[model samples]
Target: MLALAALLPLAGASFAQQKIEQQMSYEQFKAAGLDRLSPEQLANLNDWLDGKLKVETAKAAETAKQSGGDEDRRGLFLATSREPVDGTITGNFTGFGKGRSFTLDNGQVWQQIDDVSLTGVKDANPKVKITPSVIGSAWYLSIEGFNARAKVQRVK
Candidate 1:
C-alpha cells in the first residue's frame, strides 16, 4: 500500500485525474454534477479506470527498472544512479567491522548500517562509487575495483 502511494506520482496525468475522481464520495460526485451518470455509465467508467490503472502501474515499474530507480538494485547490493559518483574515500579503507563511516571527497558522509567487513583494500582516499538505492532513500557505497560494499545512510 505504501509502495502504491509512492507510485501515484509516476502514474500518467489522465490516470491521476481518474484516481482522484474515483476517490470522491457519492455526495461529492453529486455536488460535482457527475451523479447524473447512469448505472451503466458508472460501471463503464470504473472499468476504464481499472484498465488504465493497471497499465500505468506496469509502465511505472518498467520505467523505474530501466532507469535504475527501483529499490534493491539490479542484482548486487550496489545501486544505480543517474549521476555516478566518482570520488575518493577521505581516510583509510578498512572493513565496516566496527560501525565504520566513510567520508567522501564530495563532502558526503555515510555510516555503515551493519558490521559487514568489506576489507582487502586499504588506501588513503581510494576512488569509490556511491549510488542511490532503488527502494528507499538509503545509499550504497563501494570501493573502486572491489566487490565489497555496504548499505549506508547519509548522516551529513
Candidate 2:
C-alpha cells in the first residue's frame, strides 16, 4: 500500500477511477479525440489507460532496481558496478538485526534484509563498508572490527 502511495504521481490518485476530464487542456482533449467519446466509452478508455500504466510502471521499477538498483543511484549505475561504499554510520549504531537500517554519511540508507544479528554492542558513528556481492546483486554491510556481516538492501 505504501509502495503504491509512493508510486502515484498525484496524492490519493487512483488510475482506475480517474477520467480524462480536466486531465488535459480543452484544445489538447479535442486534439486527442477524447471529446467525442461517450460516457461509457470514456470509462473504457480510462480502464485501458489504468491497466497500461500499472503494467508499465511495474516494469520500469523492476528494470531500475535490477540495473541502477534498490539504492538511489544519484545518476546511474551499470549492472557491473562493483563499487564499495565506505562511510560512517549516521548517529548511534545499536548493532544489527533483520530489517534494521543504517544511514551513512554519504546520504545512502541501507536496511538489513537477512536474519543475521549482531547484538549486545553499541557505538556512535560506527564505520561501515558496503560492497556488492561478486556473483549477484546482493550487498553486504560490514562494520569495522566486526567479523560478522549483514546482507543489506538499499532503500534510498
Candidate 3:
C-alpha cells in the first residue's frame, strides 16, 4: 500500500501530461491537413475550434459595447489554420468594427462580422476582436471572412 501511494502522484501527473500532449498532437495533426480531414473529424474539429472562438469574441464584444462612446468602433476577429504542423500559429485580429447579428441554436444569439483573414496557423495567444454571430440557437460565435467561413449548427 505504501508503494502504491508513493507512485500514485507520479502516475496521475503522467496521465495528465499525456492528455495534454495528446490534445496538442491531435491539433497539430489536424492543422497539417487542412484540405484532407475526414468529414467527421473536420466537423468535430470545427465545432471544437468554434467553441473557443465564440467565448473570446463574446468577451470582446461585451467590452466594446460597454466602453462608452469614446470606445473604438473596430471589432475583433480571429482565425486559426486547420493545418497540422509544429510551431504553427493561430491567427487573431482585433478591432474589426461593426458586424451583423443573427440567431443560432438553443436560444443563443451571435454577431457575424467580416473583419480579418488568417491561414496556415495553429494557436492564437492574444485575443482578437471580430464579428459575433449565433451558432444555430444555443451559442454565439465569430466568423472571420467570407471564404474562410465555417457554418456550425446544433445536432438535432
Candidate 4:
C-alpha cells in the first residue's frame, strides 16, 4: 500500500507535467490559427477602434449641440430670382417664420415685418424682420435678388 501511494503521487506529477508541455506558446497558438493575433496587430486594432470611437463621439456631440438649446437656430431665406423692382425685392424665410416681405436696398427704410413658428432646430419661436442696411453685422441670408436676416434666441 505504501509503495502504491508513492507511485500515485509520481504519476500525478508526471500527468501534470505532460499537460503543461502540451500547451502551446503564443506564437505556436497563432500558427495553429486558433489564436491568430499578434501583439502588434492587437495594438493597431485597438488604436483604430479608439480613433473610430472618438470620431463617432465627436459627431454625436455636434449633432446634439445642433439639436439642443436656443442657440441652435438656423435660418434659410429665399430671394426672388427676378430683377429688383424699384430697389425692392420679395422673399420668404424658410427657417423660423414662413414670412414674406419686401426689402429695400437703401438703409433707414423699413417695410413690413411678420412673426412665425419653426421646428426641427433650436429656438422654436423666431422673430423675423427686413432691414435696408445690407452690410449689417448680423447673419444674413441672401439669394440672387432677395435678402433675409435671422436672429436666434434661447428660451430660458
User: TM-score per candidate, in order?
Assistant: 0.45, 0.51, 0.26, 0.23
lDDT top scorer: 2
Candidate 3, residue 109: how far the Cα is off, in Å: 32
Q: What is candidate 2's lDDT per residue for 3-105, written digit by digit as tens?
A: 2232234211112434556545688678666778888987886676566556654554566556655334521233223467889999998888999989999
* Full ranking by lDDT: 2, 1, 3, 4
- For 77-114, candidate 4 gives per-residue lDDT tens digits of 11111111222232332344533333333321222233
Candidate 4 regions exceeding 4 Å error are 1-34, 69-156
Local accuracy by lDDT, each model: 0.58, 0.67, 0.32, 0.31
> lDDT tens string, model 3, 11-37?
001011122123335565545554365
Q: Who is ahead in lDDT, 1 or 2?
A: 2
Which number leads on TM-score? Answer: 2
Cand. 2 TM to true fold: 0.51
lDDT of 1 by residue, 1-156 (tens): 132344233242222324434666677667665577678877776566566566765665566667666432322222232244567888788665546778778676777885667666567778878764332344577887777778776566
Candidate 2 worst ten-residue window by lDDT: 6-15
Model 1 residue 47 distance off true place after TM-score fit, in angstroms: 17
Error of 2 at 125 (Å): 0.3
CA RMSD for every model? 14.5, 15.7, 18.3, 29.4
